[model samples]
Structure formats: structure tokens, C-alpha cells
Target: MQTIANTTSDFIRVSSEIGTLRRLLIHSPDRGLGKVVPSKAQDWLFEDIVNLDMMRRDEYDFYVKLLLYFLDPDKIKGRVANLAPGTDRGFFKPDHPDYFASEKVIDIQCLLSDILADEVIRTKLIAAICGIERTSFKTQQQLTSVDPVELAKILISGSLPDRTMLFAPLPNFIFTRDIGIVINDHILLNKPAKQARTREALLAQYIFFNHSLFADYRDKIIEIPDNEHAFLLPDSDTARDLSRSTLEGGDVMMIGPRHLLIGCSERTTLYAAQQVMRLVFDKGVVDTVTIIKIPKKRDYMHIDTVFTQVKRNVWVLLGTLARTGDEARKQDVMHFFAPKDLSEDLKILQFRKGQEQKPIEIENLEDLLANISRNDLGATEPVTFIYSGNNEFPFGAREQWTDSCNLLALKDGVVVGYDRNDYTAEAFRQAGFDVVTAAEVLDRFERGESSPEAIENTFIMLPSAELSRARGGSHCMSLPLLREGF
Candidate 1:
């Protein structure tokens, strides 16, 4: 594995995916992006806001340009040289041995052990045991004596077609951020928060651990404390240990390589975030993590939904109400944004040096957008806002809930996002960004399209509603491995 010294540079560098990133990952919005249409959209907590056809067009252009604009030209071509602008169902095809096997078996443990052992033989071993199991080798000695690659072949040869090990496809993979976390030069393959996203974890692990571009550098993917996989705090009275023992990469953000601001949403509890912080600290991955408490609200799923970083000392805020109440319904949250001076009531919570303070306030999303142009917290910096709904009068609270504010940046000024809200595009233009659409690009993924490496960075992946039904967007679905200008 490649070994590199950790630097103390304040400007966070976004290298290759591993220790020296040569390429990155993303999900182009596809058919899956809108599987939750009609009756299910709202029930799926879609926030009653969307323009499906227009959204596709806008998102396609955004992702295409995002990668094209950020990645190195040579690197982009090398990674996506094989992809087209359409679907590739052949991705699901098994290896030749699996094809010959009569049956297959799902062996999660063996899969984990082989990859973790070391490189060289990891791929061969993974191919071998991907689908078949051995019942004859009952003794530990028999199993241990067999070479991973050989064992895999033997297992495949003995397997039956009906018993073939079925590998689950990554349906939510379009949201690439859920799979890993960028820590300086290294990136950690994170443990996912939901079973639905597990395939993404595996795919990311494969790309990072086995891919030639990243295999050399494995030491820096931040390790968990004491090699523990889970962290749960002991129960306490009154408070009920609101902190969780589990964490998802979706809730993590790097204000800087060493400085982080994380959200403790329902998927990510305070305890879990704290434990992750502890583990990160132990590994010296960051200097601090300001945990932002997110009150339970179906619409305000994650912190990124309400707030996202823009540039140096600046952010784009939704300017909605501070989350409140237990069992708070959408109607209740709507009440907060109903007033004419809704932005004034909306608070901007700042976290730096381990403490959080209210840095500024706005009367509405529009004011917040306008305010980003000036210095609010003692510093003259650029802060931008994208009103979730129409930027004009007659605020549309429902539109904000569809995650109008959630967006992922590929570089300093370029980004990838769903185009459900036109006002958001205008906001970007106002922020001086060159906006693009996802219409044709997304259709390519749905049609299994491939793009030449030169165009690889041009596309960004956005998750469909299959997983979005669970309340997340491409930004929420992805776990970034590299980030610049955080």
C-alpha cells in the first residue's frame, strides 16, 4: 500500500480517490430518479415540490459540466472511456466461472476477509467465492489450507445455477457520497447506515482497494477506534442517549480538512457522530467536528439540506425555520415559513473551534441569497442562497422540502445537483456559476449510456426516488472521497 506523510496545510487538497486520486465517482440521475412519482412522491416525503421533466434536463447539464470542468482531462478519459450515454445491463453479469457453476451462494464474510487480507490476490479471491459455498469443507483446517483464488474456482465449479450467489445491484449508487469519506489524502470506505445502500459500500470498497489507481494507498483510509465497527453509548435518563452509535457519510461535511461540521440527524445520532469524531480524532483525520443538532423533521432530513458551503467563509442557506417539536408534521414546519419575514426568523448556526453560535439571520430565502454578498459574521465574504421554491413573492414551502437546497460541488465553483427548482438555477447564475442540465445525460445512464473519458467529468450522478423515497438526494446519497475548497 502507498504511504504518504500527512501534511498540515490549511487549504484542503482533493487528490485522487485514494491516497493519490486519479478519478472520482458519481451517479447520473436516471429512471430511478423519479420512480416515486404520482401517489408515492408525497407519501415518500417528496415535500410536494418538483418539475420532473425540467429537473432531468437541468440536472443532466449540471453533472456533465461538473465533472468535465473539475477532473483532469487525461484522467477523465481514462476512467470513463468505456461508458456510453446509455445503460449497460451487462454490468450485472457474473464471471466466467460463476456462469459455469450450477448454483451460487452469498458469502459476505469470506468476501470481507479476502479483500482485507492484502492486494495481489484480493481480486482473484473475490471472483472465486463470489457465488458458491463449500459444504464439504466442514473443518477450519480444510478451509484455511485452500488458496483464495483456487478455493474460489473450486467453489464455482461445484456450484449449481439455481444456487448461484446473487450480488445485489446498487440502485442508490447515483448518490455517490454515501459510500466513503475524504480525509486529507486518504479516503475511508464507510459503513453504511441502511441496508439499501450496502451495495454502494461494497462497490466503493472494490474501486478503492482493487483499482490500480488507488490500491497503492490504503493505510490512510481512517481506521475505526480499536477496530470497532459500531459505537453506541450507554443509556441515560431523560436524555435517552440521543446520540447514536451508528453514522452515515451523508451527514458529514468538511469545513476544512482538519475542521468539520456534522449534522446529527435521525439517521446519524449525536452519540454515533461523537464516536465517529472520536475515531477520526484518534486517527488524526481532522482537528474538530462541530456537531449540529438537527431536530427530527421528515423534510429537513440532513444538515446539507438546510445549509451547504459556498466558498471561503461563506455558505448558501435555505433560511427556513429552526427545526422544532416531537412528532412535528409537515404542516407544523410549514407554519414557520408562512410569515412574510420568514427569513428573519430563520437562524444561521455557525460552528467553529468546537462550539456553535448564531452567526446571522435572514427574513426569507431571498434575503439570505442577497446577504451572501456582504460580510455578516465580522468578515466580508461571499454567501449565496437558493430559495427552495419560487424566489419571488408567495413563498412555496412545499418546494423547499424536496431538498431544493441540497447540492454537491465537484470543484471550487462547479457543482452537481437535481434541477427540480428553476429558482435554484437562477441562484447559481446569480452566484456566477455556469449551470447545465441533466436531461440528456441522465437518459444516457437510464439507457446504459457511456461517455468518453474526455466527457467523464462532465456528468454527475443523482439518485433516483427508489432510495430518495427514504428521504435523500444525490448529495445525501453520496460519500465524497475528495474535496477541494471545502
Candidate 2:
């Protein structure tokens, strides 16, 4: 709604998982959580009903504090300046105060205010919601009479003037990662699998389109079409039918500059993965896409939930999924291919619907890496995999269910995750990462006792007793916009 000149300077630039984080977009749990009743928790895509007050008091506030400390612009610049001689700290000043403000972190509520600030944006948004045209004077008057700030809150909290209209609160909106993803210099707006989450995606879409910070990147936003509308479209009459495709950001990962890894699991469909690959390639965004098909189950709802990169070539994976055929029980399969590899023959042979496609013939994680290297480069990069719970059985399963492997990388080797997963924390400690609590890091930061340069390969652990009840971790809550390239 905010019409500003598009510029490349405002675009997102994320290419790898371990890059130094610059800007992040997050949504704190709000009144939406109050609507999630015990009788309708599953309908809202929650594993169980949660206590809204406890979630806000014990979980979200602490998580925001940790994120603010790690992403502080001054600290990030200091770290870069320390690492690279002659680097200018002034160059690291972010475009928006929300990104650099140490005392204030930007939340969805703040974003909505920006969206409604512009008269044109407000009118268009209102028209879209009411299924009317912006040209209507009566509608314009009605929109103008409502205070922008109050309207923004009402829209987000789902407190419609007419209570008869069915409105479901977006409880899962706290998990920002599932709404959208930023690839190298581009934004991919996701179409969620559940209807309750569609509004979340729409809000994100509006924010990206109208937000002043993202004005220049408007053309770069790619909207994934909703699959439910497939029946409305005429049959493609082609070999590939992507109409019914669906993609969630939680299942898509940008592992490296030239490569993207997508999960065809419980939430993302194989058709959607193929479509994303084609779109990225056609736009010259990425060179290759690797599809990892994990078993369709709630536990393995997303790839990030089970695996994430910790360093340049090091990763953390769920113990069970990292194993081979006999040990893994056919739960994990890695599918790799390039844009050029897609042909009518290849499509018909590999991606035919309703038939179980042969899994990528790899014995284990090592074999999968070998395959990736063979196709993407001449030699395989040495990869060190630290499994959750040190590959120990019952403990591993237990910790993983609590999001032990769902770590968010702040820099090359530094990451953040749940403190409740003691086994995974112990594993990170044994791996030489300084396992520290969020309180310790925040205290040092507030007291000026430490800087980003003082901490390397450190895992800042946050209290997750209440947050984990939502079935997500740090990776699920934060969506990175910009990060320093490797």
C-alpha cells in the first residue's frame, strides 16, 4: 500500500544458513492464542492447547530478548570489524530502526502499523478484505473513520465488527518461518497447507508489499499459488500439474548460494517442490534444488525440525533420520537434481503422482553428501554431523520431540536453541561449542562485559518449557531477511 520506488538496495540477500544475521522478522504470540480452545487446538494446527499467558510470560519475551542481543547492529558490526581488518562499522547500519534498535524489536503489531500508515494501502487492504473495490466512496469513508492502529489490531486479533462472519485467529502466526522465506535476493511468499494459516501468509504478503523497508524488493516477491483453487482452473493438459502444489517455508532451506534444499514431507508436496525448483531456476535464482523426502508424519512435519546447518560444512541432524536403510527404517531419502535434469522423461519416470517414487539410492548421510558433491562440484566437502542426543536411542527420540535439533544459526558456528534439551546441549558442548544460557549472554551484553567477537561457536540456549508446547523451536519463530555472505 505504501508506494515507494523499487530499489535493489532494499532487497533481501540470504544465501547460506551460517551467514552473519543482519535483519530478522518475528511475530510475538498475541490475542490469536486466546482463540485457540482445547476443543479446537488441532483445527488451529497446534499439537495441544497452550496457556497463552504462560507462553507470553515464560517463553516469547525471553526469546525476543535473546534475538535482540544476537542481532544488535552495533554488536554485529563490531564482530565484522574485528574479524575483517579495515571494515567500516558505519556500513552495517540497517535501513530500518526495527532491525537495529537494541531496546526495541519489531513485531507483527509494529508491521501492521506501517501498513495502515499509508492511505492508499489502508484502502486497498480494506477493499480486499471486504471484497469491494477501492474506488467505492462509501467503503473509503468507512475505512477512514476507523483509527489505523485500532484497525490493525482488530485485523490481526480477528475482532471483526460483524461477529457473524467466521474468523479464525492465526495462533500459529508466532512461527514466522512457516509464512514465508527469503532466498538469495528474493522473497518466496508461501501458501500454507492449512486454511487457518492462509491469513498469516496473506498478512506477510501485504507487509512485504507495503512496508517501506521492502519497497524496492516488491518485484522480487514470488507468491506460491494456493492449492485449494486447483479445481477452479481448467486442466493444464500437460505432463506436470502444479495447480494443486503447496509449500510451507519451514520445509524450504537455503543451504548455500547455488543450492536449495526442500522437504517433501507432511506439509510440503512433491508437486510443490518441483514447482519451486522450476521457478527458482527459470528466474536464475539458484542452480540446483535437492529434495529430501521424509516420512509423512507430524513429528517430521518440516526439514528444519530434524536438521539444520551449524557451520560451513557441519550440520546437526536427528539421529534416526541420519542413519542408513536398516537403521533409519526407510524414513529419510535425499533426492537431488538440477534444473537441466528436468525433462518429460525424467518427470514421467520420477514424479508421477499416486505412485511411490524410488528413493534416492543413498546408504546414509555420508552417501547423500557424496551425491550432492558429485552433482554440484567435483569433490565432496567434508561434513561433520552432530546427531541430536549423540545418536543415543530413547533419549534422542525424546529430545528430538522437544525440538532438540531445531537450532538457529546466528553466524558461521554460533547458534541458538532450547535449554530444556539437555542431551543435545551436552552434545554441542562435547563438539567444542560453548554451551551458554540466554541469561548469561544477555547479562554480559547489558553490562557491557562482552561483545559478539568475545563469543564464537556458542549456543545461546533459551528456556523453552512453554514455547516447546507449540511444537516449534528458534528456527520456526524467526525469519531472517539479510545476512553477511560467506
Candidate 3:
């Protein structure tokens, strides 16, 4: 557990999604999760109340340990024999005295604390957060007196050390991928659509702008201007609000050095997508930008949830949205009688910097994925698709609900995903990828029987009973700050 004084500026590039991961951001589940009561769960964007203890100790603990092994091995390599994680609280908790504070396997809470150590930043942040929470002047004064580490915890969990509630909990902080994304070397911060996520974006903005770890690239940060009255409008029931420019990191992907993908889904609107596309093009960051528009349903909130890269030529996605018009409609006899459900259809349009009017419309999801691999990546192998739940009846929708398609690729063809999605795991196996449990892999690494370098084209399964309740997968949980370019 080492603290980061500064991460080299050159270590902040992410030109491809499936490149080897060297550094990233993640958050450990906090006590705020335990406070989500059924009455306020929907308002807070949580599907259901989760057992906080189980989610932390049994499920998320594995994710932390697994990441430590892959990115910062020395921190936990020899500690496996002595660390009784079940009984130890300090090892994983960022606020605890015995926490493993690795620089490479960075935690957002730690970065928050680091910046708060400065009196100027601490005062400014207190005012900003207090304004958003609408806290009383007395409460803001009291917060100014708290320690940086404690204050970071309180700001995120919305609880004091005495278990007193101060404001609404930022439960979605665990989904770090929604805050901001690094494209090439520039950082495009997120503008959240839902009021529930407003604080998350605010905190991220402060950290990226003020933190010395990212000081070298501060001038390159891009922000979208919201609608003049967007703040006053109550959460919209419809998905694409053109007047407002709302964007999340989950909708933005750095597919290749010369290409970027932005989704016009529930969280991101076409206005924001166009704004970002023009910004990147003017900056000469990338030459191609593709926007994939899907239904605004809560089930498919972002493009990453529908599909993510497994390898240069491999993709796992939901078949319902990837199929052609004829394939999407089942039973030709009944097709004539039933009106097509326009809501389930997917639309993809690609734009080049100088040729905006001649945008090319892609027919299906598979075609867009294959083009990225063959043309953008120059892959010699044939492109392949592994459908969610093996593209079977009932399973495709059922497993997608549990995040079978949302996976984080540790490296090309090596990924981390939930083990609960049995059908998706079988699909990975059929695609010639070996599926193994994270616990077993950890044991093997500890005993020196296997290593991260030796693993390839494999699915490292993680425990997901309680994590699934959050309705996000590893892809949503991670913010890759640095990755090797293919």
C-alpha cells in the first residue's frame, strides 16, 4: 500500500479499450449502501436494497484483491497467507489506519483526501459541496473543521463518524466509469443527467482540475455547457432531452488511436455527443467519431451495457439490439400482424472531421463492431460475436438485466466479469475463452501455480450476488486512466 506523490503525465493515455491495464480508479462500497431503504431506493437510482455487509465483505472484497494482484502485485502477493480479510476492516477501507493505499490501483476516495489536504482546496470544496447539498452555514463551518480523510468519507457516504446523516448518499460513486473518461491524453468530464448523480460529477470535476496527479493536463480538460434552465427542470421522464447536454463516461469509449465512440442513450443526449465530437476533432485528438443511439429505457442506460470490446476481433453483446430487422422479428407468420417496436431498434452513424454531411449509417451493432476491428484496428483475424446469454430465448434479456454484456477487459482477450451470469460464461467458453473463478485464480497466484502474465483470452469470474443489485458490471465500476495502445 503505497501513496502516490505524482503519477507520470505520460501514464494517462487510453487509446484502446482492450489494451493492457496499468492504472485505473475504483471505489470500495461504503456504509451509504446499507442506508438505502426501500422507500427511497428508486429515488436514489438503486433497484433494491442490498445487504451492505455481504456486498462489501463477500463480493467487492474479491474485486479489490483481484485488482491488486493484477496491477499492484507486491501489495498483496505475499500478504495472502496472513490477511484475514473477513476479520480485517482496515485493509480495504480507505479511511482506516491499516489500508492498502497503492498508487497504481488508485482509489477515488484517497485522491479526494489528498487534494483536501490543501486548505484552499478544502475550503472551496466545502463551499461547493455545501451549496449542492444545501447545507446550513453552521454545517459547512463544522465540515471545514473535519480532517481531510474523514471529510472525504463524509462527503461520499453523507454520514458523520457518529452515524449521523448529513445529506443524500452518493451510492453511485462505486460506478467510477460515469464520472470522467480519458481520451488519448485529454480528459472529458461528465455532465450527469439525473439529479442523483450531480454530486458525483461535481466531486470528479474538482479532483481532475485541482489534483497534482493530473496537473500537467489541466488545460486539456473538456466540459459541456448545460441547458440554461437544466438545473430547474425536474428529472425528465424521457431519455433524450435535446435542449440539455448531458454526458457520462460510460457512453464514451476510446476504441482506437484515431477513433472514438459516443452513445446517445438515456444518460447521454445527441446534443452532448455532437459537442464532444466537435471538441475532439478541433483538438486533433481523433479523426473519427461514431454515435450509437439506442432506446432510452432504463434497462439499456449506456452503450457499454449493451456491448463492450473483448478483443480486437471479439465482442459480447445482447442479440435483441444487434440483430437485423428480419432477425429481430421472430416468426414470419406473426410478423405481418404485429407492429414493429421502434423502441428496441438501434441506430449508428459515423462522422469524419471535414465530412459531417456525408455521415455513414451503420445497419446493425455487429457491423459497427466489425468495422472498428478490421478497419480501425487493422485486425487480420475474422470478427466474431458472443451474444448475451448465448443469444438464446429468454436468457438474452434475463442475463442482460444482470449485466452479462458489461465486462472490464484486463487486457486483450482477458477480462473480469460476474460469475452469476452462467449463460454468458458458457458463451465465452464457446468462443474459445476459458472461464475460471476469481477465487480459484487468486489461490493459484498465491501458490505460484499460475500468474496474470500467463492468462489470456480467459474470463476471470467474480462473485456478483449482491453487486448485480446495483445494476452495473465491472465495466461500469472501473475508470481506466492508463492503457497500452495496440
- On lDDT, the candidate that comes out on top is 3
Is candidate 1 or 2 superior in lDDT?
2
Backbone clashes in candidate 1 total 78
Worst 10 residues of 2 by lDDT: 341-350
Q: What is candidate 1's lDDT per residue for 1-486, written digit by digit as tens?
A: 111122333212442111212234444433333444465444333433344343434333234333442344332222332233343211211222321111111122233333434544554444433422223333223434555533332232222234332332233444556566666666655665455454445545665665443444666655332224223434462135343344556666655545555566655666666566666666766655556665555556566777664443334455344222222343544555443333333333333333323332233333432332242222354344444443432233444555555665544333455555556556666656555554444344334553322232221334333233334554564444444432
Clashing pairs in 2: 7-216
User: Model 1 — which ten-residue stretch has the worst lDDT?
Assistant: 98-107
Q: Score residue 382 of candidate 2 by CA lDDT.
A: 69
The best candidate by TM-score is 3
TM-scores, one per candidate: 0.56, 0.78, 0.94
lDDT tens digits, residues 1-486, model 2? 112222446437888777888777777776667667778888888877777666665556556656666666453332322112122222211223433333223566667766787788887776665442123556446656676666665566665455321356777887888888999988998878776676676678788887877777788888765466667777772123445677888898876777787887678887788778767877878865677777666877888888887777567877666552233322221122222211111111122122224423344544554444344333345656777776665666678888887888888788889889888888888888889877677667656788665778788887777788889888988888878875
Full ranking by TM-score: 3, 2, 1
* Candidate 3 weakest lDDT stretch, 10 residues: 329-338
Task: Estimate the TM-score for candidate 2.
Answer: 0.78
The whole-model lDDT of each prediction reads 0.43, 0.68, 0.86
Q: Return model 3's CA RMSD, one decimal.
A: 2.9
Candidate 3: regions farther than 4 A off: 1-3, 7-9, 82-91, 227-240, 324-344
Q: How much is the lDDT of residue 118 in candidate 3? A: 90
